[model samples]
Structure formats: structure tokens, C-alpha cells
Target: MKCVAQAGLYEARIPTGAPYKLRIGWADGWEEGADPYSFPPLLSHHDLHLFAEGKHRELAHMMGAQTMTIDGVAGVRFAVWAPNAKSVSVVGDFNLWNARRHPMRLRHDGGIWELFIPNVMSGSRYKYDITGPDGARLPLHADPFALASEIPPATASVVASPLDFEWHDEEWMARRSSFHAENAPLSIYECHVGSWRRPDKDGTRILTWDELKETLIPYVVDLGFTHIELMPIMAHPFDGSWGYQPLGLFAPMPRQGNPQQLASFIDACHQAGLGVILDWVPAHFPNDLHGMARFDGTCLFEHQDPREGLHPDWHTLIYNVGRNEVRGFLIASALMWLTQYHVDGLRVDAVASMLYRDYSRPHNGWLPNYYGGRENLESVEFLRELNHAVAEYAPTALMIAEESTAWPGVTRSVDSGGLGFTYKWNMGWMHDTLSYISRDPLWRRYHHDNILFGLHYAFSEKFVLPLSHDEVVHGKGSLLSRMPGEGGTRYAGLRAYLAFMWGHPGKKLLFMGAELAQWEEWDPHGELAWNMLDTPWGRGMHALVRDLNRLHRTEPTLHQRDTHSDGFAWIIGNDTENSVFAWLRYGDDGKPVLVVCNMTPVPRIDYRIGVPLPGWWAERLNTDADDYGGGGTGNAGGRSTEQIVSHGYEQSCVLYLPPLSVLYLQHEGGAG
Candidate 1:
């Protein structure tokens, strides 16, 4: 780092790795302190090489305000990439936030500015006062790689180290690679910690990570879920955005607890046999002055052109993935969650917006790519590189994409020209199923195809059937409220729908409070109506979800071959007039699990349904049972198959299908 101290802009000579104070013609005569910039850059040569090549996977180590000791002087090393800035300075409370107190030395080769200021210890709040190319002072910006940030309403970057957590989940980490989720049952309970449960109804306080280990952990375990997918925990200013507009990618929200406590919470989950999947947002960021927007008085992280950079719906700026440094920065953020926090997976948010250049934009407001197409080629390439790096660094941690488009090969291997994700959220399935189930029961017959339509493309990619927060927020009603009925009928409908979703050919994800059939649409400020859990309908839905998850994990037929077409066979798919559907799910052992669903409030008694073998089918579960608050109308115990052939099968049975319910029956060895 060389400084310009003279009127002629001559570079001053300083001693090797020694601080030598030089007099600046414009400053007060005879500055006493040695020049901090005269020291060699702490950023490694390999880091610069990989960054220039657009492939540095760990940018957090080389950039930002990292705490380190250079030349036995305890201080923080500040580094930033501002290609267009004329000068950059480390301004903070230590120097009374004056812009000129600690001017940084620029590395002309890579446009990086760096300085090692001694005695700047942890807990110091800081910012960068950048002199733009036009020599104008821009708004002071927070450190992009700040390990921690000041609590919201106070937007200063705190000097902290992220590696302070001592992990104790080596057993979970060692065996994670063996559990390839696609081959195993993955029933995720997606939850927002702040709103999931509050200390009281007044929304007085949020449950901390320590508090959660005792409550949220055991609750999910008792419900028999395999994993917990948390809403974004990254530090963000606006609470209404639901952590989607994150500013601190590296820091866990201190409001929840310190970074290490968040780590301990994740460790607790792993120790309790539950995997943790974090919702990660790398697509866009809010235009808050202290965040990434206009850093160094230029479009440093975002694109220079609004048409190519701005997100119309989110009112945020999109990351310019074309920039090598930006790509590395985002990839490193994803890695931090896995490597540092021991997270099991990531649910990438708004991937469709990242993949398309014209997403949510009018024709006049968007720009075409280099090939004059809607595809964002740079983002596509960046995604490939990101996935590649994740595989190399965190081999067991899954990368799941929330892509809503009919993109050709989202989960395919990148080697074969694909984006390389482990699984993709089945948005099409969620939409079509919800639409069909919301219709009046009498008119449901007309739209029976809506429930079965997603199966046509189900196997195109590994899918997760998510009844997520997005479907219950904004103007959309809660899951139970979406059903077109009142009182017991709606509860019955939701139970039947949950059965269908569980038996569907994919992994499962259910948002919190959905199992309780919460009536209020999701509100960020309120805790879930926990009092509902004591009601009959609430208890019934809860019981049903518990059984669903338990059964899903125990029965190999429900998950073993989930990603293939062979596991499923329709027995009553085309019975639209009756609004009834039946199917058989099979495992490797050739045994079949029979499932029947009645969408209408009309029971079909003594109805003949085909069976592959001549055996007794025991009624394993009936959503219409009295314990579940239904009329308890179902086949008593079991039914033996008759000699009569029906529905193109060798054997058949006359059975009862309860109104607005689903039944799971297991074959009892050849009717003995």
C-alpha cells in the first residue's frame, strides 16, 4: 500500500513492513503516528489470484474487517473492493467517525483498499467513508464482510469474529454424507422462530436459541419430523421483510442470540436427530444506505444499469453475478452457513428471479442478455460454480433451489449442463393442489385434474412438496381457511389434503401452525395461536400430521423410490365424477400400500376397488376416525378381498370410503 502525500501526488517511500508517518501537504503539519498503510497486505497472493480468476470460494477470510495481529500489533485488518473509488478510508467511533483520520492505501492491481490500524479491538463499531471517482463523499457504508452487525435501528458494523463457536456435533457431521436425502424420508417443518412461539400473546419477547432447544426441538421430534427448515436468520434491518432482505450474510441475527448461540441451536438440532436447513437469500438486497447498495459511491455489488439490476417487486437491488468478486462473495456466504454453523442444508430463495433477466419486469423496463434472450447467462454460470464449490467444501450439505419455472434441468448434474441442485421446491404441485382443494366440494369434480396434474412432471426433478410460508402470507388465507367450508368440514378437508400430500411422490415440507390448522393468516408480529392446540380440531390435525410424518418415515414405499415413476400406480385417477382418487405405493420388497382419498363429503359404501393380491387389507389409518374428529365412518378393522375381479385387477374388495377423508390400508398376507 502506497500513499499520495505530496501536492504533486508523489508516492512516499516507507520502511519494509514498518510504519513510517509521512507529512501530507493538505493535512496539519507533522503527523506523529507511523503510516499503517506502509505494511504489506494481509490478503494472500493466492486470494488475489483466485479472485482475479473469479473463483475465490472463501472471500470472508481475505476481505472485510478481520481481526488479526500483524507485526505483533493487535489490530483489525480492513479490506474492501471499490474499483471506481478515488480513495477509501476506515472511519469509525475509534477515530470519532472522521473520514480523514485513517485513510486507506489502494492496491492499483486489483482496486482493493487496505490498512492495518493497531489497537482496534473487537466490539468497535465502524464504517467506510469512500471518496468516489468524482471526488465526492458518499454515504458511509458498512463492511460487506462484517462478522457481526449492530442490532437493527443502529446500522453499524461491529468488529467481531465468527469462529468463536466450539462445536460438539462431530457424530452428526461424520454420518451426514451417508444419508442422501433423495433416498431417505425428508419431512421438514418449516418455521419462523420469532413468530412460531412468543413468551406471551402480547408478542412481548422472542424465544432465544437457548429457549428453543427445549421447546421447538422436542415439539418437532414428538411430531416425527426429519428436519427443520428455518426462515432466514441473517441480520437484516426490516422485520416485515421476514429476513429476506438480509444485510449481514456472515452474521447471525444477534436479536435471536449471538452467532455462537445460533450455532449451538443448530448443534442441538443435530444432536437430537434433526437436520437444519437455512433459508438463504443471494438474489437481491434492499437499498438501505448502510448495506451493499452504492458502496464506494458506485454500483460495487449491484449492476450499474437499473434495468439489469433493480428488482421491481422487492424494491431492492439485484446482485451483479457477472462481477467475479460478487460471485465469490455470495458463494462464500452460502459456505459459511454450512462450514461454520454445521447446517445440514440450504433452501435458496427466489431462484427464478436470479435465473431470468426479465423476471417480474415489463418489456420496456428490462434488458436482454448478450444473446438477446431472457436468460441470465452470468447467473446461470455463477450458479454452476456455486454448486460446484459447495460440493467440494460441504459434501453432505444439500443445496435445494426454490425455482418456480419449468427450467429444463435444475437438479441435474452440472457436468451435463445443468444448475446442479439437490432438490427443487415443487411450487407447481403446491399451487395446483391448493387450487383444487379450495374449490367447493360439489364443484371439485370439475377440477379433479388439478390435484393429479403435477404428477405428469413430478419426476422431472427431485422435488419437495412445500406448504410453505409464502402460501399463507399476505392476502392468502391460512391452510385451513383456504378450504371452502366451515367448522368440522374444513378440518376434515385439511386432514384429507395432508394425507394426499404425504402420500404424493416427493419429499414433504409443512409450515409451522399449519398442522394446527391456524385460522389467522400468518402475521410476523404475532405468535402462532398456540391456544388452538388444545381444541378438538387442532388436536385432531396435530395427530394427523404426527401420524403422517411417522408413517412417511417408517414405510419405505412412501420415500424409498420417491424420485422415480415406478413407485406409484394409479388405481382410481380418472374418477372425476365421484371426486375420489386411489393409488398404490410400492417399496423394493414388492409389497404395496393402498391409499384411498375422498375429496367430497359423500361416502361411497360397499364400493369395489381392485387389489393386486387375494388378501385382507387392514385399515391402518382413516382420517374420518372419531379420534380425529370425523364421523368415524370407515371399514371396520379390515376387509378380505373377494374372488370377483374389478377395475382390471385379479382381486377386489367391497369397502367403505368415508366422506372428506383418506384411508391407508395394508395387506394382511393373502387373507390367510
Candidate 2:
């Protein structure tokens, strides 16, 4: 196998005693040992350096040189990676989608399809016309590069840019930095910005960042959520995706606002004392022709085969991480959000898919690991490097993974055989809790183990009890919709469930309308049925939710950071009667705050539950409080010094238990 050395190639010498023959080129040729030409064509050392420099400059141009000065007007230099296309053109407000008027030049050196349109500055509407092989004309889309607006597919798109806003977030950014430094407990209010607010009437309304600053920020602050986890604000072409199919990683969705508007939104959240964490989807991208697909005359960033590049379940294109340029682009995107956007953190989406080669497995299409195993080692290495870069570039920015697999130590430090994510979504708890709550009351007892099972691995890599967007979408129904029993019983059960959620071990997250108990599943197009707030039931649920947030924040025992091994004590777990679950959250000073929840519908006359400590206790918060829209069976706020009675072999406290209620008991001086 003999071939002249070519640019962009590398060679290695074989050992003299090596017994292996050399195979080169496309497997059509072979040679005996010590054959110099047997080695693959190698790029000259100088050419390789030039190639590396060119690649670096290309990336720097995209990231650093924000406004590409052209014709005395600063516009962006747009580029897309599309190798399969024969020709590509830029069309937008300037060219009106005309292909011939704005044909992009091809850079054969890097195989990049590029165009530098003069006078087409930020806020210029655009799409691409990509002519694929066989004369198939496809409209190339917005480069995920610094785009300001997107049509959100199935909706009209307009021209917008990042330079169109007044931001006020310096103070907030400083405060957020301090908060992260202290490792403060984060309670995230995950929301979709568009659907978070809409016009009172129905003719297509979008809430400006100012509008959300005026309305949503105060509400979240009052609700006591320490952080706001926004659904992907990165520009995407589909509204139905809930912002998952990102077409532009650098630009916030134009429908919401320009880059400045988004900055203002984050600034507003910071001013309101809330940290912002973006939900980032690097797992796959939309296969919109107007986007990444073959924009550069090749499958430059993605795998060539549909089987290798496409996400079967999501119908999207997956990036080829093995490509150094592609990997650097993604890493750069992550850093861009942290450094430029000043985002407090990121929740990496669909990481399980990214970490696996045969994620949604097919019929023997994927390659095996080097050791003939069914693992994707390349993917794992990519994740490890990603985490390392994130930590190095943005120490304060938390990196969370939405990894549902049993991949061990996902949240552990990179040096410790882990992916080094700050936290991973506790999918186990979410599944168990949702399943248990959806069952009938009689059967609810049978599923009592659900809560306890979650606790078993509760401390495994810091977990977040995520009642996320997934639960509200895909026909899963709203949180309230999942409750069992009828009318008041159902309401009480829902209330008890919330109380239990907040009282559990791990941080908590509630999607957009869950705080108000919106009965309908999430609708991406409109507000959260604010009219529901006018109803008595709605008002009651709203107040209860608000109070829950207040309770979670005000009580040191309820704060996730405070309720660790020092504070957590499981007093009772009885599987026989399918009733009686009790746990205690204590203060740093060892003062106990007990929680006893009975899932039964009937009042228990003399329920005996063992107490972790022997002492007087006071009712702090109860789901059955009259103000909370529950029956008046709650004990008034005061201390109780009852003597401990014997139940079986354990010393216990017997109290009249309310059906479908959570009782919180704290030692007299335990309040923190």
C-alpha cells in the first residue's frame, strides 16, 4: 500500500520486529513490514500547523468577532456545516429567500459553506436554500450562530438580533456569584418563558422580558424558589418541542426577544434574587433543512448515515463528537452561555442519549466497544472532557445532567470515575412518586414503599426531585390530575403529596403552572389559564403552593442542604397495614422536626408512631389547615408535652390522625 503523503494526514512508524502486515488506503491494498509508503499519507508538519491555526481562527471568528464589519455596517458572517449539499445560499429579509442573489462561497480548505453578506446586520430575517444532490432544493435554515429569532416551526418568524435591549443585571450577577460560592440550596422553578405568560385574549401574544420582569419575577421571588430553570431559550424552529430542538445555540429564541431582551430577563431574575439555569440540549439538533443539515456541502458536523446520525425517537441529527472541530464547537457553546449570558448554571438535556451509542437500539447498526462490549467509550470520553472544560471555564456555573440511566457516579468528580456533573435528575423518585400518587387511595397504601425506595438512593450524587416539564407533557397529565379519590379527597391527597415532596430529602423543582395546580397539561402557546385563579379551588391551591414555598424557605429543617444525615431520621416504616410513614428533619443543633403522613381516607383513632427523640413537640405546618382549604382537624400552632407511650417494643406518640394529611411536628425550640 503506497501513496504520497497528503495534507491533513498523520503517520506512525512500525517496530522492526512487528509481525503485522500494513493495510492502508481503503483496504484495497496491503504491504509487507518496513514499507514506508505502507503508512497512510501524512500531512507535512508545517501544513498541519497551518491547518490547526485556520481551524482556531474560524472558531474565534464565530465566537469572538461578534459583529463582522461589512460595507461599513457590522453584520454577522454566517456559516453552516452541510457537506451533502452541492450549493447553499443565504436568503432572509435582505434577499427575500432568493437563492441566486446571495449564493454562499464554498471554502474547500475546511469544507465549510460560508457567506459574508454586506449590510445584512443583526435583526435581518433569513433562511438558506441548500441544493442537495440530484437537484433537490432545500431551504437552508438559520445558523445556530448568534441568531436572534426563529419561526418556532408551525409559527411565523421575524428578524431580530442580540443588540436590541437595555440590560440591568450587574448587581444581580455579583449576588449570583456570591450565592454559588456559598453553595446555597437551589430550589428551581423550571418554566417555559413563552408559555409562562401570554395575552389575556388569544390572538398570538408574546411576553417581553420586561413583561416577565414585571410579572413572573416577583411571583417566583415570592414563591421562594431560589433558582429559575428555563426551558431551552436557544433558538429552535418548533414551538411543540418545548424548546428542545435547538437550531441556534448562540441565540436566544427571537420570538421571546433579542439577545439584550434575554439578558434583561436574566438580569431581572437576578435583581429579584433568583438564579437562572438554562436547559441545554446538545444531544441532538433539529433536522430542518434550513439549519445544520449539509450547509457546508457535507455532513461536516453530523454523521453521514441517517442510522448513525439520526435520533430515532426524537427525529433529530446527533453530532459526531469524534470530530475535534465538532467537539470544540459544542464546548465553546457551553462556555459562551456561561461567560456571555452570565447564566448561573445549565441542565444538560437527554444526556442518557448522548452517553450511549445504542441509546434507543436498532438492529445491529452500532459499533461495539474496543473490548467487544456494548458501551460507547467515545461518548463517555466526550462527556468527561465536557465536564472538565465546563468546570475549568466556569467554576460557579453548575452542570446538571438529565441522565436517567443507572450510570454510576454521574455527579461525582471527574477524577473519581464519574461524569462530574453537579447533580443528576432523580428519575427514580419521579417515577415512583407519580405512579403511587396516580393510584386509588386503597391501592396507594400498597404502593407505600415508593417513598421509601427513593430515600434509599436519595443521597446518591446530590439529587433533584424533579417534577419537570416531561410529567406535564406527552399526555401524562398535570400534577393535580394524577391524584386519586374524588373532589375534596383528591385535593387533600394532592396537598399531602406536595407536603411530602417538600419534606423529602433532595432539592425540588416544579414546572411552570404546577404551582397553581393547572388542571390541563402544559400548553406551549399560551398563559397558564390565569382565569383558573379566579376559581375558589384554584385560589386555594395557589395559596397552598405559595405557603409551601414559604414554608420550605423559612424553615431551616426543610431546606435541602440542612436536611442531611445530621437531620434526617426515619422513625417508622410499616408495610403491613399499608399505612403510617414517618420521618424527622432536625436542625443543626439536634432539635427534631417530625413529619407523619397517613395516606388513608379514614381517620385513625389511635395511630402510634415511634418518635426519634423523647420530648414535647409542636405542630408547625399541616396540610389540613383550614386556611389551606382542608378540613379543620389540624392542631393549633402550639407545643405539646405528651408522655411517650409504648407501642410494641418502641416508645411512641399516639395522636388522632387525619385522613390524607401531613402533620409536621417540631420540638418547641427547633425553629431555625
Candidate 3:
């Protein structure tokens, strides 16, 4: 007994199905059962080698608390990486939250500590009790790889079952390759899950995953949005951060129900012919104590240097991208969502912040990379490796970047020395267009270049023109409120802006509530004013958006040549005198859709515009039409092009240009 106590080792077998107590210390004895140390190593040497090299893209299966039934002892195998910890233990309700009850054994390969507790069934809450390098008591941390977490107001990680679901999305998975952005109609609806819909006004309860399946899927399908981009579904401590400050990178928040329920929601989306995109944040994480901050009582997940690690704008901690394990961890989390949850894509948030070392900082406040350059070399390499890993793991899954900079090759292939993203959010266009439209129409002609400047570099990258949640929140006001005019003029201007955006030369993305022309700035904690649909402006605005989405999808000329510069050309490039702009969007087959926007409040009569073909031009959509609660100043049904040439086109049309309206016209019965 003395030798066993002194050695702190058990060479012989302790009988199973009994509580084994270590009574060597002055404190109360440990009533730990079935020595987890006695079990063989969970990970192989090769696996550890790869993890250290930052190549372990499938760590989701290895690093987290995995449900296993080894030798008929059904329980969870908890594993965590804290290389500098003096000692680590798995503490939970099973052991009365006593850290000494189940001390985990340190792994030899990569500083991973692991312990398997028998009969620790699913739904049991647990956390890691880590001792720091200097032997200080570190705060217990929530599991970084937990598949599900306790509902907010609690910070424990739940023991989740192996993520297995009887998925009925075989058809979607099989045909996903065809849905890539380059060849498909990509219109995304950016949504915040909790704020998307609520039954009550006080914001007490959020819609569950099951409830969302019944509501969100059908709504998106009806609106003809190809994909619904959810703002981070990962488990976060604060609801107001909107899942941006995540603690459990692998776990879906329990507030929405279990992991399987979220899976079922995704399955329902696929069944209803809607793809789902998750807004993934790998840029920075909140500095919550129970989170990645000061992990293992050291700056493990983040950089030790504040200039390099802390985000100036968000007050969060930036990931230490130079660390190989961190890269592996980040990539693995991304792949887990794509592979396990069957998510169609990931829109990587705050990529511009990640790319630059001196982002939002007074130049000297930040550090330079190896070459003394402002570009973060480590972050660049990490992003490249992440994109490579995602491509290899989930070939059809998209990697989008919300990068606001003019950084070249953002959507270009890695082989060509670019970031290799599938699509990029056009922040430049969003900001410029919004600024231009906010000007009074009387002064719009003088600032006409603001509206036309985007086309100069429109095809620079695969861009998703976004009027996202960022535009509507934080006192930026709603889309309806952003217009320069008031009353009916504002409504007409907003509808025109939307139509123009839909016809613009990029993939489309619109935030929720914008379709209803919501006048109030978005409130994360309150339900949207859905009852506004009863009002005239609201009903008309809602109907206009539905028609716009339908028109955007059905018109081949709008998207077929979107990636090419030749697809767009100016028909009336210099007619800024009356605050008017005309352009043509062309299909690859040479068919064209002509667009004319009138930004002023006064209607123009006998306005002559050029058309590609001399035929009956149908009025496909008019933002000022009575259908959209406008003054309805537009050509009745159609306009016939005159034989007289104008603006160097083969023919011209004299029509009524409605005030604060944009018109989409298609040549009826005209061939290329």
C-alpha cells in the first residue's frame, strides 16, 4: 500500500464495478471509479503528429468529448489540449464538481489530457479543471469542442451523443456540386436566428430549431432565396453579441434545442430546396473568462502580446494564427459544420481585420510581420491552409469572405496567389450606393459618379452585393429610413434602390426585415414589426421585394454574364442632368435586359432611351407602379422602340420615366 501510494501508480488491476479510493492525502479520499489512466491512449502517434503539424482537419472526431462504449463501459471520453498545464482534471456533477476526483492523464504526443468516465451518460454537464504552468488554480473552462452547451446563464459543457442523424438530404448532397456560385443563381438571405422571429413582443423565447423548420424554410423558399445565411449558431455566452463571441466552437447553442434538432432544421431546409450558410467567425473571440481567454492560465489560444492578439475595435482576442494547432483547430471547426451539419457554405466574418496587422490601429500600436510589413503573414498562411483543407474535405462547400478592403485576388484561386474564396461581400458597393442614395434627388445629378463608380471595377472579383445586418443595426437606421425623402417618396426611392441592387452585377444578399421595409432600426432582443404588413406602404414594399427576387432569378440576362465585364454596358452614361442612369445587362447568348433608374422626385415625360432591339419592350418591373404603392407614373404595360437611333443604339424608345423609380425592360420576341 505504501509503494502504491508513493509511486502514484496502479500496476495491478482494480476490480471493476466498485469505487476506488486513493487515501494517500490529508484531504478527503477520491472516490473515482474504473481508472481512466489505465486505459490505452485514445489518439495514435500519427494523429498527434498531424495535429502538431496543423494538418488534422478531422479533429472534430478526436479532440472533443466523444461518446464511446469501450469494453461495455458506456461513457464519454473527454479530451482537451493544454500543453502547459501542470495538472488537469475532468470535473462535473458526477463527481460533485471535485477536481481531485478524476485527474486526467497527460498525453505524450501534443499536451492533450484525456480521461474516460464510465456511465457518464449523455446530457451530463462537465468542465476542465486545469492547473497552470506556475501551479496556480485556473478557472474551470467550458469545453472548446463541446457539441452542445448548457443554456445561457450557465457555463457547463454537455455530454452530447455521437452526432448521428437519419438525414434525408441524400439528393441535396449528391447535387451540391452543381450549386456552386460560378454556375448557379446565388441569392442569399442573411438572418439572425433568434431575432428572425419571436412569438411574443417582450423577446422572452426564441424559436426552437423545430419551430424554425416549420417557419423559416418555407418563408425563404417562398421568397425564392437560394440560401439562408444564419449569423453564427455556435454557443456564445451573450445573446446580444449575436453568436459572434462564441465559446463552444463545435457546439450548437442549447437555447435552440439539442444538436440533432439543429440538424433536423438543416435537413428541412434541404428538403424544401434551400441551402444553408453559417456566418462563421474565426477573426476574433470575446474575452470572457470561461472562454478561450487566458486558457490554461496562459495566452494559449490567443497571442501573448496585446498588440498582436487583442482586437482594438471589438475588444476581443485575435487567434494566434502562427500556432499550428490553432490553425488545425479553426479549420476542423469549419469542416465540422460543413460535414456534420450538412451546411452548404460558410461566410467567414471580419476577414479584413484578420488580413491586416495594423487594422483600425494607429500604425505604431501594432506589430509588423517577419518582413516588417503591415500584412499579417501568419494569418494569410492560415487562411490559405484553411481554404485548402475545406476544399479537400468538403469540395462543394463555399468559403466566403466579408472583406471590406480592396485587397486583390480575394476571390481568386490560391494557385494564382489569391485568398481563394468562393465569393466576397462588396462592402465598397454597399457603402457607396447607400451614401449616394441618401443624397436629396435635387443634388443627385452632381454626385452621379458615386452611383456609377462601382462599374469601373465591378468584375474585379466574385462579389456578393450585401445589404446585410451590419447596414441596418447599430443606429445606421433601416433601409427605408436611409432614403433622402419622406412619406411616399422615401418608399418609392427604397423600392427603386432594391430593384437596382437586384439588377446589379453581383450575387445578391439582403438582411432580414428589409423586405418588409422595416422603418425601425433592427433590435436584436425584440421581434420584428411583422404586423406592419397591414399598412399600405408595408404591403406594397413586401410585394415589391417578392417580385424583385422572382425577377432576379428568372432573368438569364441578369446573371448569365455576371462574371464577365461584357455582360454590362452603359447606354446613357452621361445623362446626369436629370438624375437618370441607363445601362444594359446581357446574357451570354447576347440577349439583354435594359435598366433605367430615375432618382429625382419629378416624373420625366417623353424620355428617350436607347434599346438594343427595335421591338415591343415589356415593362418587366416599375418601382413606382401602384402595385408597390407609388404614384404609378410609368408606361402602361409596354413601350415600342422608335426607328430613330439614340445613344448610339440601333433604336430608341420614348416613355414616361416614373419619379424615384427603376424600370427593368425586356425586348419581347427579339432574338440575338
Give the candidate number with the greatest lDDT: 1
TM-score sort, best first? 3, 1, 2
**Candidate 3 C-alpha error for residue 454, in Å:** 0.6
Clashing pairs in 3: none
Per-prediction TM-score, please?
A: 0.94, 0.83, 0.95
Better of 1 and 3 by lDDT: 1
Using TM-score as the measure, the top candidate is: 3
Instruction: TM-score winner between 2 and 3, please give it.
Output: 3
State each model's C-alpha RMSD to the native.
Answer: 3.5, 12.0, 2.9
Candidate 3 per-residue C-alpha lDDT over 1-672 given as tens digits, one digit per residue, 9 for 90 to 100: 434665354355567755453433436654444556556677778878888888887888888688898776677888888989999998988877998778887886787888877768788899989999999988899888788789988999888898889999999999988867584678999998888889655578899999899888898888888899999989999988998888888998888889889999999999898999999999999988787888888899999999999999989999998999998899999999999999999999999999999999996899988888999988888888888888888989988999999998988888889888999999999999999899888888888888889998899999899999999888899998999877888898899899999888998999999888899989998867798788889888888888887877777788877778988989886878898889998886665788999889888899999787888888899998887888877888888888887899878999889888899988885432
- For all candidates in order, the CA lDDT equals 0.87, 0.70, 0.86
Residues 217-310 of candidate 1 have per-residue lDDT tens digits of: 9999999999999999998989888999999998888788877788889989988989999999999999998788988788889998999889
Q: List candidate 2 stretches off by more than 4 Å.
A: 1-119, 126-141, 150-167, 181-183, 363-365, 560-566, 638-652, 669-672
Instruction: State, as a TM-score between 0 and 1, how close model 2 is to the true structure.
Output: 0.83
